[model samples]
Target chain A: MAARHTRNIVDRPIWKSKGEASTVSFSAFAFLFSELIQYSQTKVKSTAELENRLEVAGGEIGRRLLELLTYREKAPKRKTRLLDLLKFVHTTVWPYMFGKTADSLEQANAADDEYMISDVNLALTKYISVPRDMGSFNPGALAAGIVKGILDAAGFPARVSTHYVDVPGLSKPQTTILMKFEPSVMQREARLEPRAT
Target chain B: MALIYSLYIINKSGGLIFHKDFAPISRVDLNDSLRLASIWHSLNAISVQLSPVPSCTGIELLEAETFNLHSFQSVTGTKFVLVVDPRASSVPAFLQRVYQLYTDYVLKNPFYEVEMPIRCELFDAHIEAAVQKYPMMS
Candidate 1:
C-alpha cells in the first residue's frame, strides 16, 4: 500500500519561512549577555553558586525549547535509547545553536557510564574573548550549563561540563563537554535495560 | 560566488570571529567590519539582551547598503550572528527563522553554549536560502 497523501502532511511547514533573512549586530548580543552574566553574578557568592544560577538560566531555555521542538516531532514519536537521545541533542540540537553539530562524540574505553561529546568550536567564546581578570569564570562554562540543562530536562541526567581544550587556529578554544552519569542514572539504565542478552 | 558582503562577529572584548554573506554582493572590508564589530560588541551586548525579556540580546539585525547583520542571544548568553543581503525583503523573517532555528537546534543541542557565536551549519544553510533570494548587484 502507498503512504497517506494528506495535504496537511505533505504541506507541513517547518520552522523556516519565506521572508528575507533577519540581521543584527554581534555587538548587540555580546554586551547584553555580558551584563546578564554580571547581574546574575550578583545573585551568588560562591563560584558554584554563580555557575548554578547560570545553569538554572539555561534550564529555562532547555525546558521551553524541548517543548517547542518535541511538539514538532509529536507524531510518530520514535522510541529513543539513552544513547540515541544523546545523539539527538548532538545532531539536531547542537546545529540549531552553532549552525552545526558537535565536532565528535566518544565513549570512555575505561569507564562504562562515561560519554564524551566534543565540539572543537563552541560558539560562546568564538567572538567575545573572556578576559583574564575573571578568574575561574569561563564564559564557555555557561554553554556547558546550557547543555546540562537540556540533558537533564530530557531525562538524561548526566554531569556535563565545558572545558577550553586546545585547538590549533580557532582561538575560541574547542570545548570538550564531558558528560558523567550519576549512580541513579546508571541504576535506571540497568532497570530499563532490555534483556536482549 | 561573489562577495555577499558578510557581517562580522566580534567578542565582547573585540575580535574577528565569524563571517558569512547570504547573497553575492559588493566588496567588504573583513578587517574593518571585524574591528567595528568588536568595538561595538560591548555596547550591543549590554543593550540587546535586555529586550522584552532580559535574555534576548545578541546581533539583532545588520541592514545597510549591502548586507544586514543580525544576532540571537541565547539564554546562557551565547550569540548567533547572521549576515544577509541588504536588499532581501525577508530579512526580518530570516532573523525570526534563525531564532526559530536557535530555539529548535542550538538551544536544544546539548553541545551549544548560550550567547555564543553561531557555528551551526544548519542555521547557516537556512540563512543562506533566506537571504539568497536577493538580487545580485550589477
Candidate 2:
C-alpha cells in the first residue's frame, strides 16, 4: 500500500493530494495583474475610462475578498453591527489579505450616510509604473474599487476610490484609498442599531 | 526584544535602490544609513568583481542575533535586508513573502522605483502585518 502511494511531481504537495490546495505565487499574480491592466487599457480611449476600468477591476477583487473573508471560516458568532463590520474591514479583514489597516477612517463631510476609510498605500499596484503613453495608473485606486465591489456585493453598498495623497518626505509616495458608504447604508444601520447602554 | 535593524536592496551594478530601517539602531549615526548603503554598495560590487561573471554570490544571506539581521541577494541582483526579531522562525518563508510582495506590489506598480527603498503603502502594510505576527514584536 505504501509503495503504491507514489507522489506525482505535478501534485507533490501532500496537503493537496488530500484535497487541499496551496497559495498562489506573486509571479503568477504579476502576470495576472499585468494582463488585467492591459485588458483594462484596451477598453478605453480616455483617462476616465481607464480609471473606471481599474476601479471595476478592484471591485471584482473586493467581491472575492469579501466572500473569502466572511465565509472562509466557521465562527461561533457571525459579524454583527455596522461599526463591527467597518472595523472588521479596516483592521481585521484588510490586513489579513492586503497586510495593513487603513491609514485613517473619517466621517464624510456634510454627509450622514457616508463614511471613509483612507489607506495611504494599496499593495496590489506597488510595482506597476504607468507609462507616459498610459494615463496615470494607480493600483491603490483599483484596490479601493475592489473594496467597494466587495462591500456592494455583500449588500453593504459603498463606493471606494484610491487617490495619491502626497506626503512630506517619503521614499515612495503615499496613496489615499477612500471608501464612501451610500445613504441606504445609514438607514439600514439605523434600523439594525443596537440599543444604547 | 530583537529588533530589525534595516532593509536594503542593491542592484548588481552597485546601485542602491532601497534601504529601510525597520527598527531603531542607535550609535550607528543618522547619516549611517546612507554611509552604510554606500559601503554595502561597494561591498556588493567588490563581491561581484571578485567572483566570476554570472558566478558571483547570488542571494547571499548574513545572520545576526541568529534570527535577527539577515541579508539576501537574488541572481537578478535584488538584495533584501531584514532586521527582524530573534525568535521569528522560518527566515526563508519570511524572505520569500517579502520578495513576493516586492515582485507583486512594488515591482508591478509603475510608480515604484527600482533599487530604491520601497515606499509603497502596500509594502509597508504587509510588513507591518508580518511584524505584528512576530511574537517578540509588539
Candidate 3:
C-alpha cells in the first residue's frame, strides 16, 4: 500500500522565531531525570558505576549544548582560553541548564591545574534519595561530566569529579565539581601567556 | 517555492546512519545510498585538502538541474545532507536544527550505540513532525 502523500513536510524552520523563549517545566525534567537515575541503577553493580553512566549521559548533553549555545551567540565566537571557557560555563552554561548560575567558581590553592564550581543544591539530585547502603553515590557526577565535556570540546583536556561539601550554616549539602587540567593544557597556557616586560 | 525532499545523516567513517524521505520519489536502494555516502565522504576530504584556508568546512550546497542538496558537517565529523527545492534559502538553519535533534534523540537514546544505524522512534517522530510543517512545491 502507498503511504499517504502529505504536503509541506519540510518547508518550515526548526526553531521558533522568538529565541530563548522556549522552556520545559522543571517538574517534568526532574521526573525524567529521576527515572534515568533509577534505570542506570538497575544496570550497574556499584554506585560508582551508576554514577559513571549518569556522568557519560550528562557529558553527551554538555557537548551538544556547548555547540548550540555558541552557534546561537555568534557575535563573539566561543571562548578559547582556559579561564574564559570556565567562566563561560559558570556564568552562561550553568544558568541555561539549571535556571541559575553556579554559587561559586574557585581555583584550588594547592594545585595550579585545579578549578571548582560549587552549587548549594544540585538540581538533578535534589529530589533523588539514595539508599543508605549505597556508598559515595553522588548524582552530581553528571554535572561534573558536563563540565568536563564542555572543557574538553573547547580543547582543554581535564578530569572532573563531583564532591559533597558541608558548610556550617547551610541546610542543604553543597556540591562541588573539581576539574583538574592535564599537563599539556597547562603547558599550552604557559606558552600563550604574555611575558612580563 | 521551497521544499525539502529528503535528508541523509552520514557518520565520520562514511557510514549512512540515517535517511528519511519527505516527498514521494523513486525509492533509493539501500546499497546505492551507502555507496553515495562513502563517495561523498571522500570528495569532502579532497575538497578540504584543496581549500585555501586551514580548515575546509566541507560542501554546503550542490545545485542540480531539478533540485539542490545542502550539507553541514559538525565538529565531531557527522554530516547532515538535505535535498531540497532549488530556491530553498533556509538550508543552513534547517541543517542546524537537524543536528540538534540528532544530538538529543539519537545520541541521548540509551539504547542507541554510537555510529550504528539509527533506530530511535522518538527521533523519527520528531523529524516527521518537523518536516510536516513545510509546504511541498507544486
Candidate 4:
C-alpha cells in the first residue's frame, strides 16, 4: 500500500496537486496575454473592438475559474448579495488570479448602482505599453471581463468596464474596473437585504 | 480492444462543434455525426421538458447493448457526449478533464470563436492524449 501510494504521488501531474495553489510564471502569462491582444488587434478594425475581444476571451476564463475556485474553497458558498459578490472579486478572485488584492473597492457617489475596483499595477497590464494612437485603450479590459463574468455568473448582472484613473502620488495610473449593476440586480439585492438580517 | 467509441461536442444552440471517432468500429462521416449531435441535442431538451422535477438536467447516461453514452453539460449549455464501452470506468473523470482541455486550448485560443467548430490543433492533440490515458476495462 505504501509503495502504491508513493507511486501515485510520483506519477501525479503538477496541476493535479490537491488543495495547493497552482500558478504559471508571470512571463509565460504575459507572453500569452500579449499575443491574445495582438491577435485581437488583427481581427478587429478599432481599438474598442480589440478590447471587446479580449474581454470576451477573459470572460470565458472567468466563468470557468468561478466554478474551479469556488470548488477549491474550503467551505464553498455562493455569494448571493451584491456586496458579498463584489468583496469576493476584490479579495478572493483578485489575489487568486493576479497574485495580489485590489487597491480599493468604492461605491461611486454619482450613482447608486455603480462601483469601482482599482488595482495599482494590474498584472495583465504590467508589461503592456499601449501605443499613443490607441488612446485610452486599456488591456485591463480583460480583467474587467473577468469581473463581469464572475458577477454575471453569480446572478448579479453588471456591465463592467475598464478605465485608466490617474491617482495622485502614483507613478502610473491605476486600472479601475467600473461595475454598474442592472436594475434587476439592485432590486434583488434590496429584496435579499431585508430578509438576511 | 477499443473501450471508447467516439466523442461529440455540441454548442448551446444545438450545433455540432466537434466530433471524433476513437475506434474503427464506430466511425461516422461528418454529416452523420452532425445530424446525430442535433438529434441528441433535441432529445436532451425533450428529456428536460418531460422531467417531473424542477431544474432537471437532461439525459445523462444511455445504455445500449454494445456501448454506453455518457453526456455532460456545462453551466453555459455546451454538451460533451462520450461513447464508451458498457463496462468502462471513470468516464465522468475523463469527461471533466476533456472539459478542462476545451477551456484551456479552445476557449483560450484567440483565433477560436465562441459557439463555432473547434479547430484547435492543440485541443485535438490533448484530447487524443486524454483518450489514451483513460482506463478502459476489456
In the range A1-197, model 4's lDDT, one tens digit per residue, is 34534655558553434445657887678658867776777889998898899889878878887887787666789877888778888888988887778999999999999999998888777645565577898889999998888888888888989999999998678999999999999888788776644
What would the per-residue lDDT of candidate 2 be over residues A33-75, giving only the tens digit for each residue?
Answer: 7777767667778766778888877778777777666664445
lDDT of 1 by residue, B1-138 (tens): 423445444444555545665434554676766666665667676665656676445546656775566665545444446565555454455555655644554444333355466575444555566455544555
Candidate 3: Cα lDDT at A97: 87
The docking quality of candidate 3, as DockQ, is 0.01
Across B1-138, the per-residue lDDT of candidate 3 in tens digits comes to 338888999999999999888877776889999998888888888888889988678788889998898889998999999998887667788888888878766665444567888886658877887787665556
For residues A1-197, what per-residue lDDT tens digits would candidate 1 score against the true structure? 12323435447454433332224454555555666667876777866676677767777777666655555553625424677767766876676566677889888788888887787656655434343444455556666777677778777788876666777876445667778888877787889888996
What is the TM-score (0 to 1) of chain A in model 2? 0.72
| Candidate 4 whole-model C-alpha lDDT, 0 to 1 | 0.84
Per-residue lDDT, model 3, residue B71, is: 85
After TM-score superposition, what is the CA distance of residue B105 in candidate 3 from its true location, in Å? 28
Q: How many clashing pairs per prediction, in order?
A: 58, 27, 5, 0
Interface RMSD of each: 10.1, 4.8, 10.4, 9.7
Better of 1 and 3 by TM-score: 3
Clashing pairs in 4: none
User: Model 2: what TM-score?
Assistant: 0.50
lDDT (0 to 1) per candidate? 0.60, 0.64, 0.80, 0.84
In candidate 1, the second chain superimposes onto the true chain B with a TM-score of 0.50
